[model samples]
Target: MTDLDAETEFLGEWGRFQQQTFFLLCLTVIPNAFTALSIVFVADTPPHRCLVPAHVNLSAAWRNSSIPLEEDSHGGGPRPSRCSRYRLGDIRNFSDGGLLPGVDVNLSTVATEGCVDGWEYDRTTYDSTISSEWNLVCDEGWKKPMSSSVVFCGYLLGALVSGQVADRFGRKIVLVVSIGAHSVFATILAFSSSWTMFCVIYFIVALAHTSRTGSAFVLGTEILSTRVRKIFSTVGGNMFFCVGYMLLPLAAFFIRGWRMLLLALALPSFLLLTLWWCVTESPRWLLSQGRAEEAEAIVRDAAKKNQIEPPAVIFGPSHNECKPERRKAHNICDLLRTRNIRWISLTLWVIWNTLTVAYYALSLNTSNVHGNKYLNCFLSAAVEIPAYILSWIMFRWCSRRRSLFSTLFMGGLFLLLTLLVPANLVHVAVALEMMGKFAVTTAFSIMYAYTVEVYPTVLRNTALGACSMASRIGSIVAPYAIYLRSYSISLPYILIGSLTVLSGLLSLLLPESNGMPLPDTITHMQDFPGCCKKTPYKLTQTEENEPAAEGKCPVVS
Candidate 1:
């Protein structure tokens, strides 16, 4: 692949073609942000109470205050109970006597019953959300997060299925198909007549969403040279994702209704269909599939864009050298067959799970915090701009392991500090939580680049799929983790923070891949510096004396 990359004149380390491709692909990520985080608004549980029935014949004063005051499960002090309503028949006499509600009557003696007439929700924040529309409070409150979990389960399914499909077909085809599938399902989701239907359609949306995301990322990455890959991966790609995220609050602010918000999110997805005309398939992927002619044409076009002439023999022996060995076709089992790779794979799994859980938990819990849900979500998304910028900058100067470790450790430290901050200083606690979000976001950005560099090309996609599946598991569990807030406010933060710290320590075990060449085979992986013991390896005279290039693999002594 290094030789292949070097052979292409237009796939410059940093050139005009790369710039155009970077921005074009970055555009594809905006809708992704919408699809991923819309649940924050759609399932929002606004201030609500039981609906007082007209048949009760109570006065307006009693009707408004019919719901009893009770201690909140999350320690918000005394608030109107959401589920129970007083036996209106018993309380009607007091209300009809023209007495004040709670002050004049011993409301404490009134027996309570579950809400039989449904509920009334505060329309100040949202005109209608799924929670309000479906009465998903009290006994059904759990369903809110369940919808999000179902989507992640869809992500897990996509992770398992998309990689093989992409490999068997092509990155561009899977990407295009996934974009269409995502849009179609998402649009249909807006017309859902029941909670069950929304969840079902949402599952398909999640499946397609992950597929499109994986394909888009790989297609963009495969076409770039190592010198500029990180720039596109973090700044150009993930930064746009952040922008889409920031746009969500603004959209939610205006639309103010769940169905309208869904429509707003779906409308932009149609624009992505235009990408089929503009975006080209990865030349690298084409070459891997034995379609050398197609790959060469894409390269020539890129060279033309960059104002360079292709060599008559664009791909020489370097392109064909590894073809025979590569024909073996590796799978996930290869990651565990060798002892050293097994250790690396296991550690990477832990890091991936930790980052995903920490990231999703923080994002989902933002709505539950004591503030404007939209503002909190926007701030959370906005902070990522700097976090990503810092990650990109750090990757340039710091070793991969060092940057990853420090960010993960700092994220955990901030989350842990929230426990010590008093509840009265909620602003201080939120500030600390945002700081934690920032650190974890930085680490999340770094992990993608790190994972690619660590795995060999043969098993790279498969390993990434496996890692992605592990990440989906984290996302699936994140809602439950955040649900812990119902029992204790700090529990989710504590759990996420502790896991992040442990993952940071585990990351120390991975080899530094900052300037190493991309490994083409398992043998090449074993020879690179790693967690295993540094046993001196035998090398031929020619290999031992080979000089190293800046971004090429150095011969092992």
Candidate 2:
């Protein structure tokens, strides 16, 4: 019998054992959610202007009016210049002349100079953030978003090594180690004395955090039956991630300091350490590693907890055969060795990178979306709930490829619509952005499942690892995408929208996997309808080693 058949007999779908394990694993995603986007608050830049030095003898009105007004480079609104002030000497002279502040002082004619005295931040919303503490304003504005990019760079570095290490050292060990390391570093990140120190520590925190979350997700997924896999991934994992996202705004509302906020985000991981006692290793992983005895023991334990009797022979005899030849692992070269698989691999990478970039671009842009930052963040996260539900429903009722592409295109379309919205109608623009966010959220959920379905099992994990690394690269670039607002406010939306639509078009070139059995080999993968040459794929053992032919894609069945 196959692994799925054995899993059905031994564990049953959604049994008590599965539910318990899923819940424990899902709990871990909460803290991950907090850390992933905590930068939104931690590095937030509230309304600010150059500080009016106390030493300058100026009236309160003169002090307030001293900062010259300038046209916003991004949105063209009139606002006080963040990095400049009316020349201090001019203000000092005006005050010395006994002219009351705001009393016919042609402030526009006054010369302006770079702020010599740093800045004063509006504290009504946020008491303090990294942007305020480090004066990362004006000339230093890029550092705010770059801080996030630094974390994602760490994610890229970790993705490079974590999967191979997890596959070799076991998922549970890596998951636990990453969690501990993430927590420790995250705590240190809160106490950062300099922006450089924060970036360095945050990088390590991101690496450990991504590694832990990825391993936990995979471990939880591998142990579940196919019947509930989609639900667990979409509703359980993605929805729970949204829950953490939603909670961030609420937490920030009360805890206004950036250091305290980072502390809050970091502290939750310590609580996650408790799960090490409750969560079990993946039985599938054990079997793959040829530890059949441990695999059976886990299955039996699951059966007992599920209140079901195990069969006398819990595992098939094939599980006990230690074939050293079967231990050979496929590498990146294997994914590109075939024509159909290579095309599918490249297309999948595009979709992954596009979706991830667009998703993070929108997520990071919430602060600039013309609403209460906390409200915008909450609404942005809240939208993901319905998005995940729609994803779950779509996976159940629609073609995976169609739903995936449609959602991506629709998201792009909504973001594109934002450009036509009049600048005065900021509320309308924000609404459209939220709609785009909802669609992108749905597409993200669909893409995760669809990617797994596209590749053969032998190269599945490797393919996913590659795609995840691509995603991290996208994330690393996402901040700069959002930063484009410095040039034009519409640029970020236009860029993300255009790329998302292009990704939808690219997705259409790939085969649909709905209702199809997963391919087990490169030959089987190439044989899938719409992924092959006009001629049927039949590879002889010797021919199988050859590079796939280029430049042809069969029509979808």
Q: Pick the candidate with the highest TM-score.
A: 1
Per-residue alpha-carbon lDDT of candidate 1 for residues 276-316, written as tens digits (9 for 90 to 100)? 87788877666655556777788888888888877777764
Error of 2 at 483 (Å): 1.8
Please give the lDDT score at residue 317 for candidate 1.
Answer: 38
- Per-candidate Cα lDDT values, in order, are 0.81, 0.79
| Angstrom error at residue 165, model 2 | 1.6
lDDT of 2 by residue, 300-333 (tens): 8888999999888866555565442445576767
Model 1 misplaced regions, further than 4 Å: 9-11, 93-105, 317-326, 526-557
Quote the lDDT for 32 in model 1: 81
Each model's number of backbone clashes? Answer: 0, 0
Worst 10 residues of 1 by lDDT: 548-557
Task: State every prediction's TM-score relative to the real structure.
Answer: 0.92, 0.91
Error of 2 at 230 (Å): 1.3
